[model samples]
Target: MDNTAKSAAILNGRLAEETTRRFTERTFRIFNDADHLSHLASKWKNVAADKAQGHMFEQLETIKFNYDALRKDSELFAKTTASMVLGTDPVDIIISDGKKTLREVQAKSCNHAAASTFALSDKKYAEMMRLSPSDQHAEIEKLLKQRIAAGTLKAGDYEQTLRNLKKDLQYDNVSSGGTTYQQATEATNQSVADRVADEFRVKSALTDMHESGKRAGNMGAAVAGGISAISEGFALFKGEKELGEVTVNIVLASAKGYATGYAVTALSKGVTHTASYYLGTGVASTLARSNAPVAIASGVVNASKSMIAFMQGEIDAEQLSDEISHTAITSTASFYYGAVGQAIIPIPVVGALVGAGVGYFIGNMIHQSGLLALGDSAVVKAAKAHRKQVEAMCLAAIPEIQRHRHEMEQMLSQHFAERKAHFTDAFSAMDAALYEWEPDNFMTGLTVINDQFGGVLPFKNFSEFDAFMKSDEALEF
Candidate 1:
């Protein structure tokens, strides 16, 4: 292929791969949201249903905010956690952007019939009144530690709460809004019914974000695929392919691009997500949200191709091994390059793409150079193998060839002796007939000659032969 064709193929492949990765990543996040919601429901089972649901919405909104912030600045890290401190801490959720506290949310759910208002729980007020200041501080710290041990809070949460406690235990914010419940149901069901609409809104917004991301990825991939097809068409045309052939080539290329894109993207996402358990969400999110997945997908694709080639006998085991090693090393380089690129450019996908592309090129170049260096040795090894094979074949044929030669010699010697005896006998008979005028001897010589000439004589005896020779037919001959 020419440079133009090569470039087109590369572009098409990269675009397809990237498009697929983005789509799959978005899809994964959508499912992740569902899982998160389920976990939250289970975790907050002891809390009032309405309160738990409202808190869930609050947490999701915070998550949505963090996602938006990260898009604007990758370096900015934001997260939300449900506050688990005991004794009416007033803070239902904590929000941070990794550097400092952004907000401490006190979420309250109330139906329209009850009131569009909220206040600190009675328990909190009582504690504030009953406990001395120092004792209150100590008790709050003790509760924070207990919450941490019970898996209700993290170390970060513990630290943030302690910091707040040291600063006079102030509640930052309260989240209460007019809900959709117009008529008051039973007191128990009123809050739940009122917040139902709000819960839907929050969930829908998050879902829409995921869907939007997926659609964008799909659209980008489609554009890339179209461009790829056009490039391929031009390449095929330059090579003087027929119109039909060019069309077929373009279609096949497109189909393959899409198939590979989806397959590799899904595989890479699955691997990354599974690894996230060990890597932590921050590190995992960085990988998933960036083009590092592309590097992983690329390696997987190359490895798959190598395995297929080996199975089809197009590559030997040694070559397959080399390819696997090359893919692993190149992929690692690509991933690191992509990560660095993300850091430097911090423009989401673009930076990662540029870095990964450069890394792949460099890695491939090194591999190719190594192959070239070993080319002579490989050729010499092949030549030696071929020579040995030829020698073995010759050795195998020697015994059979000797057997055939011996048989031919025996047959030829026996035939020569038999011919010599027959010739001597015929000549003696002829000489006797010619010198001594013996008719019987002449007849015998003629018979021998006839037999040697394949027995074409018509007469069976001398009397019949003499009668025919004296007839008019004999005179005509």
Candidate 2:
């Protein structure tokens, strides 16, 4: 094969691999959720069938939401990957010169029928349109008044429902004359349209910032980590055994190391928390995408940074007393960055924090190495004693932890009797929902590939595309 064909084939293989990886991750998330909800359903088994069914439905919805998310991301990944392979600027692929963007492509993508019709109004537009002008106007006023009356909304606030409604109507050439039916009717229509458009615009801006932040956080963390690693490696290579002679030196270094190591982690966690209050693509998958690289950078930088910070006197040794070993263990654990290690704390932010705590462990290890190399003085002995105390306390907590675990297990058994059928049904339904989208997802990905090559694919339509994807050659992938 020619170089171009070989490159194209290689890109195709990569895209396929990436898509499968994404799909598997999403599937695991969906099933993990299904399992959790299944446990919840079992707990609620004593409750009414309707309540149990509600939990079951929630499990199904989680599966569908995650499945669709996977498809969308996979298609986006494919588009970007194809653009790169085809020598098109992938970053600008969504909006090339005088072209419709990824948003337009998404709208046109082959997909399932939506369960609900798109409404132009936030209100019951269909039902409201049936009413006379005066009634329609009254309904609009009622909604506004209801919102204002509720403590949740304020009349004077710029984004307040009532305030925005008045402004939208007036801006749209629809007078809000209190007594006129015609004016009220026009105002009602204008309000809904304006509100929806404004919401979409606001949401889009926030989404872009959030997505940009995800990449930025990863880059920042990676850079800091890389620098730290290089510096530390150089020190170790030179046989520089002592991090610092004084306690003040060690503390400053530990702080600086932590800052470098967790910079991306902190930003990613912060952005994720803030974005949760709004709408966006999401944080979980993006974080997952960058975790391995971030982890490696974090671990290396953290070790080096802590040692350097101590030598530079950024941290006081006084601050290092009694906490060296704990710090060492915690730092190491936090920066370890294994999927299974973080799995115990499902919430990424919490997991990161826990991991951060574990970083102290690494710091302590470094401190011990320094103490041994530089000769243990009074300060070092005190620090060592503190570390021993910390270890003793941790060992003392084991029995209590085991007792708590036993009690929790016994309690769970009480609520989980004879509920295997319900769990099976929920999981089966989730799998079925996911399967329905699989074909469309494959076609969508192929469409992106074809578009990237400027219609170079053998297929002329979706049917042909589908056939091509299902062939033995494609299946071999």
Candidate 3:
């Protein structure tokens, strides 16, 4: 295929991918929320359960962020397990680039602002040594302060420096194998300190991720803009669009997409919130936990887009109506299918996502088929053919029209310059005659004036000049 066709195909594919991903992502989130509700109902009173819930939330967030990064940005590959075996792995998540490990992430949902109060232990200290140097230093400082407060070490006994403390504790750089009594004690202290630092890091990461996720409209806008830019870039490469047009299109598309996404998200949330007040928490929560909101939001956004396109004269009224109807039907189908999917699959979130996806796919296929049938109609075909003919004729005449315009401009400019020069010369001569009061100067002025009239002056002497002035053939006053 040509670049034009290829670029169009890729753009369409991207649009489809975005729609599917949005639906499925929203579906999964709803189910995840439902799971949280179930937990709250059953184990709300248990402190341990609350802790477990927090941990699970952190883990899920980490997995989701990594998964999105991989899918959207094509970043490093992450090996994530839904279930983790306790004591089997020290890290909560491992990230690689297909060839080598990039990072070992330890997820924690603890409050970062709180001071570490866990007692120092030998095994913990050893683990602290495995962390980066900055982390190790920070942990050691905290531990030393704790020990000093407890009166285990005199304030003057050791300098607060990491090097001094390590030396005094008989600490070695080794992470594994043979441990002395002093080393073990120091290691134990370091481990507890390490926990404090690790929690801080995890919490910091989670906070940033949460903040980013909360700006869903901005993210959606960016994604849409980026996709448009890529598509336009392809067109630029194919000489189908100029740089200025592409830039403007990208900016406008981003702004429009952002407004639509933001409005839809806000409106959907508002509707759900308002419903909760009237329907009670239980009913509202159930409604909030379903795919209906996502479907409705998507449909509204799509319909708005169609309306905009129609207003811009990009589509006819019939096409606009069809698009709105298609969006409504598809959205309705997906919402109901999601419920059926959950019932059939008996999985927490997987079934709903799969079912909604299937529903959307079927709806889209039918919509496209209907559009194709409409396009093949006689009136539509004739309109298209007429448009093509007009476009071809315009293209053919453009060069000739431009050529004529350029020639006319040049001719007008030349004529203007010539006339201006003649007027300037005549005026200057007349001024010189008036100032000098001499026959030679007057004659020069008259000669210049005669030249202006194509040398048509009829007299050379005073008598002929008087007769010429008196005669009807003379120039009118």
Candidate 4:
């Protein structure tokens, strides 16, 4: 192959590897890491007992369903979004009327064949074969159209299926058995269609926000995250029949923080614009920059409020420390990247990329400096002590977590058996009726490992998680 072709092949191979890695990396971590296994096991033990065990297993099933559903929904969302962007309709199913296309289906299913639905059984098939060639073709066409009109058969993606009422739909042979006589069938795949619609709305909203002249990167992140939070929150409510106070609190807090941060950033940008236009470039211009002051004030006020609440016995010290660290890190990052660094770049698309890269580097440097300066603070010391305590607690729970793994698996097995009883098809039985305790993919593997193991993973937070994930051992795993 030529150099260009060789380069393309190499990149394609890398893309495949990355995709595979994304799906399998979590499983690798859970299976190989003792700490993660123990933590998961502990969680399972706490929840997986008696009547509650069934619900816990169901949650696992829901998670697996969510993963597959999300992947499919995401693909559909992308296709639909692309079509919208390009000013075209998404066509997945179509009907051809002999000489030309009869219909391009964008909806969940076509209702063109709603009049008559029939499937030929084994006896009916034998009788059908006795008919002459012309008679057989005519009968088959009539039956097929009836089925199509009734939405009885799987039309499949974009393949041309004959739907002409004027001519005979030709086929080499007619084979029939089992449910050939389709009377009335409810929409079997509407759930997937509904999920795709939900994803489409989220994608559309994000696109709308981006087109509305907001900074594309920031707007994209906020919109996507906000939509996801809403979707997940709704799912939890629907599944559990009740929302937890802690869950609600966390969601509200996140939303509040995001809004506050956005306001601060926008106000800073406005101030920067005014200063640049009136004050001109100098020491005055530098001093006039709004991000540093706004960010610092925002962080201090939020963090200090939590800290003061803790001192007054209104909240725990751990919660206060978390607020402090979170505010400090986030505000520091925003100040550098969103404000100071972004101002240096003027190009739209290219400038965003350049600004983000420079901003992250500057942000990291400032964060490290700030951390060192604040090392002597009581909150910092408390956070460190709390971390140690958490680690010790997790380590101590390992054996108990290990014990619960088998119990959880037994619960899952029962759950699976009950579901299997409702299905006759082996494939369907395997798909929905069975739950694997030891899955090869990340999400299930993590769930299983934590349920079986006594303690959680050793990683302190996302930074540690990242470090471990990028390690040589992780790659090999």
Candidate 5:
């Protein structure tokens, strides 16, 4: 790497960083919904401009009319009803006009219907609703006792309390339960709550899960916001679209259709250097991209700028999948200097070795770390662990099988992020090497770096990653 190229490399790195910063700062709106994209939204307005649009508008008008009519009709004729599950009445309604009293069934229908919906009318109905305890008529008391004895009414407990119940019937030696109004009310409330809880099967575990998910979802919004800002910042900075020089031309990712974005550049033809090694981040401000945050957001970025955010975020999802770490990663800037550096190097064989330079970089990268790529043995353990862990997570879900779903999700978060970050690093590292660090005697460099010991790397650390894949070992609530 010559001084001029180093300067150019640094400058190009700064430009890439500027692109990423612009991307982040420009996107990540908290209130913004990610699912909404201009491509989709634009279609809605475009309908009116074409034959399709005009037809859509007419259809929409009909739908709008139907909606309004349906709502109006529902409001006019329908009653807003909630489930009113009453514990079978302990006492029957009584009727009295300060004179004779009569026992009434526990219902609210009158002899005649009224025009007002949800409201009943009939002087007899009005008179029946206002019965007082003093009315204490004998006939009502007899019916109440008969109903209780016959088990026609399931709960006599509430009606038995003389103090708690406001009755129109006289208790001719009928009031014998020691109950007060307040106690009766409390018991009633408790009974209702118990019934409701039973109906929904609302146990503690489900409650906790629901709340945890809700909280995580809320926090995820903040995460989403932060991601958006970083995305936008990168975009804004890269608005100039100054094409970067191809520093390393690694194997074109013939990765079947869509595995693109694998080119690299070290030295922009015209730019001033500011640092020892400038690292290119991502483009696309406001990115609706695959979660490649590990590549641009962590130690993978300008290793010199900030490591904590990138590193933490990289491993964040690795906890989800270890490939995250294996595929995408961090390597020194010196590790991937391709043709551009060779261009500036001007070492004895310049034009004679033009094709060889690119070829050598690719072959060396493949022989080295690239051999330990995604499907490699090192990543096998982590991958298996992640698969089983996720499967165990789903399998354990049933008629309330496992209690520690939280722990499962945590494990998921760690492994998923790990896998994502790992792959991001690995794949990117290949390109970086091809373009940024074209080492002399590529094969020697590959062999030296290939077998070297590193963090037992998440890809190789399978035991802990896949420890919980059995039903027998599952946690109990």
Candidate 6:
């Protein structure tokens, strides 16, 4: 048995009853019926979808009739276990397809597209914005004091303010700078005290303001220093002004203080603009492959993972459409055992064939997918042998592949966690008012991630700020 089928059998055992009900019920029902049992022995096939493979069955009765084969079997489990022992990368399914089909399915060429953001060294952004966290910390402390004064928070607000200030200041030198959080906080506190003290003894408001000209000076100095360093360091990608706009885009939050937070939200909601956002410079430019190519390959890889997860989620989808499906695990019998029962499952020739041989031969006939089966295949054995040819390659690639898979899985987990919270807010934000949406941009607004503070900040572009914030509570403050 193939790993997929083995995994499927494992999944059937481990799968949540409700999950099966929710996703694959339609396909399940079709294979599980009784009448189709006799006809199941014929040649079987699958329709290749743009993104995934389709599961088919002879009929419901055949599926219902031969519950033993479809159910997880020890022999099937052992076969899959042995395959894994030999070592195989699940992703090789697609890679083999690319190799055989002579297409861009596996190894894709990378190009530079501006939209997919690269992880760049923003040491300059950090160094220039070094004073920002401290300034914001001071501002937060003062605001905390005011909140306390207004009785907005409990008396413990002082300690909370100090704690938050201390925490916020730690990230200042994350990329660069010598000052510690405590040191920065102390500096900001001193300026805050000087500004407040000046307010107390001064007679004229202008004099007091002048005495506190320091705060504006600090903010201005921060901004000016940032701009100057940014210019000198050339931190941003230099691209055509009209075609690609450089942005030190500030994401202001409702929190009592100012801190730029540009959290990466889900790409599922991001605009699929067809252009390279980066001009191929710095580390981004130095990448072995062009960013555009990396992104396209990454997209294909991302889609593959997404499709597997989608299919898993739909394991029980057959229940929904009342479809039943079966596997081609072959079992043999003698004359003494044969007369007792024939596996009268759906396609007669197919069911008989499935019983006589492994799923590989019959499934191959239907889909012409050599990639799907490899138990006795030359191609698979060669790949496995080549992997062993390099001692380090076998050890390194397999574990690394597994590790990377887990890492991508974790990334997706984080992405979905963030996505659910955002979509929840979005649906809540629109509520009954969502019905007012129109193509002319009347009541409905773009749902793009224009702003970085929170949620899917919707807009075709960052051209409209007022419209983007009109709904989000996170943005409201």
Q: Using TM-score as the measure, which candidate wins?
A: 1
> Lowest-lDDT window of 10 residues in candidate 4?
175-184
**Looking at model 2, which ten-residue stretch has the lowest summed lDDT?**
107-116
- TM-score, candidate 3, is 0.33
lDDT of 6 by residue, 169-191 (tens): 11212111122223322222334
RMSD of each: 18.4, 45.4, 25.5, 43.1, 40.3, 50.4
Off by over 4 Å in 4: 1-294, 304-322, 337-345, 348-373, 376-477
- Estimate, for each residue in 446-474, the C-alpha lDDT of model 3 and write its tens digit: 77767767875555545666777788884
1 or 4, which is superior by lDDT? 1
lDDT of 6: 0.27
Model 5, position 216: C-alpha lDDT score: 30
User: lDDT winner among the candidates?
Assistant: 1
Model 1 vs truth, CA RMSD = 18.4
Clashes of 5: 87
Q: Candidates 2 and 5: which is better by TM-score?
A: 2
Q: Which stretches of candidate 3 lie over 4 Å from their true place?
A: 1-214, 308-315, 338-355, 369-477
CA lDDT of each candidate? 0.50, 0.37, 0.48, 0.36, 0.29, 0.27
The stretch of ten residues in a row with the least summed lDDT in candidate 1 is: 175-184
What range of 10 consecutive residues in model 3 has the weakest lDDT sum?
A: 167-176
Better-scoring candidate (TM-score), 5 or 6: 5
**What is the number of residue pairs that collide in model 4?**
21
lDDT of 2 at 147: 49
Q: Could you arrange the candidates by lDDT from highest to lowest?
A: 1, 3, 2, 4, 5, 6
